[model samples]
Target: MLPSPFAFERPSTIAGAVRAVGKSGDGMFYSGGTELLLALKLRVIHTDRLIDIKGINGLDRIALNDANDIELGARCTHNKIANDPVIRAHVPALSSLCANVANIRIRSVGTIGGNLCFGEPHADPLTMLAALDARLVLIGPSGTRVVHADDFIRSELETVREPDELLTVIAFSRPTGPVTYRRFKHGERPSVNVAMAWSLGPSGRTIRSARVRVGALGSRPQPLKAIEDVLQGISVAEVRPAIEAVLPTALGELEVNEDRHGGAEYKRHLAGVLLLRNADEAIAAAGSA
Candidate 1:
């Protein structure tokens, strides 16, 4: 089905885009048009005005900040993030996740901001950003503000962003050690994916710090903080059971449903397996480095 009739506006400047959104109560910003267009066609989203930001200059570049953090432009595509040298070096887990998003065609046009903003529960980046403690930069008439990625999502498909605010960039401190990620998909499409990042600190032969993010298992990517807390000073081999033990409680409050992908029990089970495997892989990678 085709999208409902809507007025379109291409804003060449950030100010122009902000103004356009402010003018209409139900306006939606257009980036890669991958998810937004599909939502519109399905009548899931209705907007009188579509503000296109793709033509705006300088919003498509990817740069690493002085702090060694990545500053990903809101318009940066999945393909760009997946292949960017800076991203690969600083956050290899993120790069790996981006590379696995959908397929080549979708990644070519899907923007990072779009992916996060769409607020899909199963999307990979949300989990990665949360685990990395990434910050989102927003620009609006009231000026710019930085928000923690974990705090940005208020609920499913909801965020703190105001109507006039444009998500400009995402920034996060780079990981200090080798990182690895693993995801379990059913027949090529990812049913559940887990990402683990590891770094070594002053303590020798121990996990200095770790971040675990579980996707496709909750409304938002649920961080395995309980497991992380358990692993902080313990040997990597000793933490696997703790990781497994926390799953029932970690996901106790969440509502896991049976979808075309799998049953509730299956998702719950996969979440545990993926977490164990990812944590193990990340720990091995950190030790090897």
Candidate 2:
């Protein structure tokens, strides 16, 4: 099916783009339109107007800020991110994830902003971003507001973004230790994915803190608080045994859903499996560093 008739407007400025969308009342800001255009064609989403922000300057930049946080412009495509020197140096795991997202065609054209805005639970970026404690910057008529990645997605296919707000940047502090991600998939999207970020002690062998997020098993990626708690203050050599001890209880805490991916129990099991795999990689990274 074709998309419903809609007006199109291209704005060269962020303010102008926001105004155009707010004025239309049902207008959506268009960047790489990979998912948006598909949703439109399938009639899964409707908009009276598409406010194109592609002409806006600086929305596709990737840079390290004065505070040492890495900022990714909302319009940056997966292909660019995967190949960016800054991304590869600061967060190679994320660079690898971007390089492997969907296919070459989608990576070339799908904007990170659109992926988060679409809020598909079966997707990738959000899970890793949440684990990295990334913040999303949104600009609207009222001004700019920064939201934690974990809080950005409100539900499956839903986010906290206001219709008139434009997602401008994704920022995160440089990782102090290893960051790892793993996913299990049988189709276009992940059935289960896990992202884990660690903060090691000065010795670089002790885990001072850990953040674990499991995705594609619930409405949104959720923290495995139980696992995180167990890993804290433990040495890399003890991670496997420690995780194994608490694995069952931690897996039980997840709120998984039975869908085409698998049964709820099966997904919960996958989450545990991926977390351990991520833990192993993180241990190796920490050891080598």
Candidate 3:
């Protein structure tokens, strides 16, 4: 595949990279080029210049802060996140998600920031991060801003980031309860995926709070607010039916698109199925904890 000739810049520092972009609206930041190169090859996106941010220092670091929040560098590859000891211990569900992203090659080269910035509907991390209540760190020419993961992606193939903005890190407080995720995939990317996070009460036997996010059937991940409301304050014993009872209505309200992934109805059905499966795993893990 041939991509249109474009000027490329590799800056050694974040500031240099930001300045290199200048005011040209046609230039785009590049990191790990998995999605960018594909889009370029397809000619779905056209840009006169490519600013490579991967050359910037410390962009691939993943560490835990004193507050126990996980700070994941945006340039961190899926392989790095998947294999990092801190990530595996603090957020194993996320590690599992990263481990299973695409095939080996893509995971090796795909940066989490680039993945989120690309805003592919069927991708995995956004849904899990939304449920995890992760905060995205974005840097632009002016300064840096933090945004909740839920507010980052506005729709399919779209995000709240301006062209001049580069996502730098993804941060989230460690989960107090077991987190679980499940996806229904007929191909490489998920057709429909579900992520559930729970906050166990002091007893560890009761659910204090929960989050349910359904993805891949629509432009972006959507929270099943009603289902979450139903699960709160319930005992572990009731986790299944409580979620299932309200799930039908919750899934109905989510915006499902009839895309190549599947028909609207089929995707909706898969959403329910994957959610139920994830619920089972989460409940079991909580019990063991």
Candidate 4:
């Protein structure tokens, strides 16, 4: 497969990148071309020009921002995040997710921003990001604004971002307790992924709160709000039975669609399995603490 002819550009500044993409939507912001180029090759998407944002300074940095949030530059590749000490220390689950994304080749070259922008339902990041309650900062010619991770993707291969806006960073607060992500891989991508995060009380035995999200079974990662509600304040020891009680109904709420991955019922079942596994990890963390 071959991509159609397109003009290439490397913009050194964010404003320059935004200007290059313009209001008419003929151009696209390209960093790691892992997703964009493949889509182009498959003729799933088209663009007359690609504005590369990798050259823009500071867009590749990963650090804690002034807002007390961990800010990951949109261009930070999966390998960078996976290998970073800060990410491993503050958000080990995220680091592990990044480390296990696709294969070594993809991890070496794919950017988290590209992964989110591609909006592939079977991908891993969205579930974890949603569980983390992350926020994405989009920069545009007009101005900049924040979008919740939950609201960023409208559907598969679709986002609320304007054509002229470029995603600059992903930010989230430090987890107050055990944070965990788990996924079932069918091949290079996940068939269904689950992410569970907790906020624990002083002794870490009581769950202050939890966020649960399931992906690869819907248009985008959908929150298991029902399951989350059940997890709040539950003892670490009781997480299993408590979550299992509501698991069926909670999985039923996700808009599961059968595809090459598997049937709706099987995938939904895997979602429950993954979530429980994550909860088990959380329990171990609490016990060790």
Candidate 5:
């Protein structure tokens, strides 16, 4: 079905875009329309106006900040991120994930900000960003605020972003150690995905901290706190064993949805498998480092 007629406005500034969307109360900021266009055509979402923010400068840049954080402009496409030298050097796992999101067409046109704003449970970037402890920068008429990635998505197809707010940047401290991601999928979207980041001690032989996020099994990416706790302060050689002891408990803590992906138990099991795989990759990376 074709979408209902709507007005389109191309704004040259973030403030202008925010004002345009806020004025209509039913307007949306448009960049890469991969998800929005499809939903509009199917009548799942209807907007009175689309405030094009592409012309707003600096929304598509990828750079490393002075603080050593990787800042990805909200309008950046998956292909752009996957091939960016800064992204590849600092967060290669994220680069690989973006390179394979959906296909070449979607990667070439789907903006990361749109993907996160869509808040799809089965999506990829949200999970990886959560593990990286990324910060999402939202700009609105009232003011600007930064939200941690885990808090950005409220539930399935829903985020904390107000209609009037614009997501301008995604920033994360460059990983201090190995970063790994693994996923299982039967179609375009993943069934279960895991992202793990470790902060190795100065000696590079012990874990100072760890972050584990399991995605696609719940409304939002969830942290495996139990596994992370066990991995902390442990030597590299003990990493796998430590995780093995707590893996089942951590997987059980996840809120799995038995949807088209698979049975709840099956998806939960896949999360464990992927987490272990990520651990192995991290272990190898540490060994070689």
Candidate 6:
């Protein structure tokens, strides 16, 4: 299936892209055109215009600023992030996730902002961003406003971006402690990916902070905050029970429809298994560091 007829514009400036999208009201931004093109071909979305931002300068660069944060342009591709030295050194968790976001082909063309903005439940960026407490910079007619990763995605394919706003930059603080990230994938479908990141305190025995993000199990990425709360200040030996205690509660809220993979029960079980395995790996990584 081909996409519905749509007008295309290559906006040279951020303001221009914002104006175009604002005017069409039904326009979608295109970067790399990997996912959007596929969605369009499948008729998953209907739009009157395509505001291509590839022509816009400066949105494709990756930089680590004076604030010691990794700042990425909206158009930065997965491959760029995965291989960037700054990103690798500062936020290896994000780099690890990016490295695993499909094969090299998809990563070569998939934009960081495009992936996050699409809000796919199983996308790696959401989970990694949640762990890093990333911030999104949105530019609109009214100027720029920043939003945290946690508040950006309201639901599956739903975001808080205004019609006139374009996501320009994604920024996150550098990780101060040793970080470990792990994920489970169901074959190569790029769905039902579950990931968790863990960081230990100075004492090296207590869990200072942690993040648990489950994708492909629900309409939106689910963070296991209850489990995170339980892990805080606990010794590594006690983390397993904390993870187990919240597994059922976390899986209960997901909408795991039967797919080629398996049934809801199977997905729920996978989520628990992923939580345990990743949690252990993360703890181990921190302990060794």
**Model 3 per-residue lDDT tens digits across residues 115-200:** 99999998999999999999999888879999999899887788999888878889999889989899988778999989999999
Model 3 worst lDDT window (10 residues): 16-25
Candidate 6 per-residue C-alpha lDDT over 177-203 given as tens digits, one digit per residue, 9 for 90 to 100:
645555566654445555555566776
lDDT tens string, model 4, 1-289? 9989999999888998998987999999998898888899999889999998889998889997676789899899999999988899889989999999999888999899999988888899988999999999999978999999999889888999888999999999988899998888888999999988899998889999999888888888889989889989888999899988998889888888899989988998898888888988999998998
Report, for every candidate in turn, its global Cα lDDT versus the true structure: 0.78, 0.93, 0.90, 0.90, 0.93, 0.78
Q: Give, for candidate 5, the lowest lDDT window spanning 10 residues.
A: 16-25
> Candidate 6 — what's its lDDT?
0.78
Candidate 1 regions exceeding 4 Å error are 186-189, 241-255
Name the candidate, 1 or 5, with the larger TM-score value.
Answer: 5
Report the CA-based lDDT of candidate 4 relative to the real structure.
0.90
Candidate 2's residue-wise lDDT over 197-229, tens digit each?
999899998999999999998889999898899
Say which prediction, candidate 1 or candidate 3, comes out ahead on TM-score: 3
Top candidate (TM-score): 5
Window of ten residues with lowest summed lDDT in model 6? 188-197
Candidate 1 residue-wise lDDT, 215-288, digit = tens: 76656676777767777777766666767777677655445757877888888778777777777776577566
User: What TM-score does candidate 2 reach?
Assistant: 0.98
Q: Tell me each candidate's TM-score.
A: 0.90, 0.98, 0.97, 0.97, 0.99, 0.87
Q: What's the CA error at residue 21 for candidate 3, in Å? A: 1.4
Please count the clashing residue pairs in each candidate, in the order shown: 0, 0, 0, 0, 0, 0
